[model samples]
Target: MIGIVYITAGSMENASEIARELVVRRLAACVNMFPTFSIYRWEEKVEEQNEIVLLVKTDSSRLDEIIGTVKHLHTYSLPAIEFWEVKGEEEYLDWVHVNSS
Candidate 1:
């Protein structure tokens, strides 16, 4: 199966660094990052901030390693990380599995 991991970072540099690490370690096949704004409750107060989002594509088998690497490399004390199984083109999914492996 395929998996997509969603993560948010404080800055473009941070996001890029995390993406690079994941790709280099073969934990992710590819990472797409973009700037976004987030509004959420933290410390019992609503907070809004500009952030970078990373969309990580990989094989489901690598999900645990991806999460561990992100936690080790992420700057935030509590980074936003989520993952879900997905379906996609067969060829593309095969490529993801090959690269992640």
Candidate 2:
């Protein structure tokens, strides 16, 4: 199975660092990062801030490792890390599995 992990980082540099680590460790086949504005409740207060979103593509089997890595590298005490099982083109899915494995 293939999966896409959605995570948010404090900045582009942080996002890049996490992305590089994931790729180097073969936990992710590819990572796409972009700037985003986020609003959420924290500590009983609503907050708004700018953030970088990281989209990680990988084999679903690697999700546990990916989560651990992200937790270790992420700056936030509680980072937003979510994922969903996804279906893409066959060749792409194969490529992701090979690279991540």
Candidate 3:
């Protein structure tokens, strides 16, 4: 099974750092980062902010390790980490499975 993990970082630097580490550790096959605007309720107040979003590709089996690494390296008290099962081209999914292992 392939998983697409979504993580929001405070800045581009943080996003890049996380992406690099994940790839280096073979926990993620690829990570795409982009600027995004996020709006959500926190502490009973609605807040909006600019953030960097990371789209991470990996095998579902690696999800736990990926989440742990992100939590360890993340600066936020509560970072956004979410994932969902994904279906992609066979070759690509196979590549992800191989690399993520």
Regions of model 2 farther than 4 Å from truth = none
TM-score of each: 0.96, 0.97, 0.96
TM-score between candidate 3 and the true structure: 0.96
Off by over 4 Å in 3: none
lDDT of each: 0.92, 0.94, 0.94
What ranking emerges by lDDT with the best candidate at the front?
Answer: 3, 2, 1
lDDT at position 72, candidate 3? 92
Summarize candidate 1's per-residue lDDT along 26-96 as a digit string, tens digits.
98899999999999999999999999999999888888898899999899999988987889889999999
RMSD of each: 0.7, 0.6, 0.7
List of clashing residue pairs for candidate 2? none
As a TM-score, model 2 comes out at 0.97
Score residue 37 of candidate 1 by CA lDDT: 93
The candidate with the higher TM-score, 1 or 2, is 2
Q: Give per-residue CA lDDT, model 2, range 1-101, as digits (tens).
A: 89899999998988999999999999999999999999999999999999999999998898899999999999999988898899889998999999998
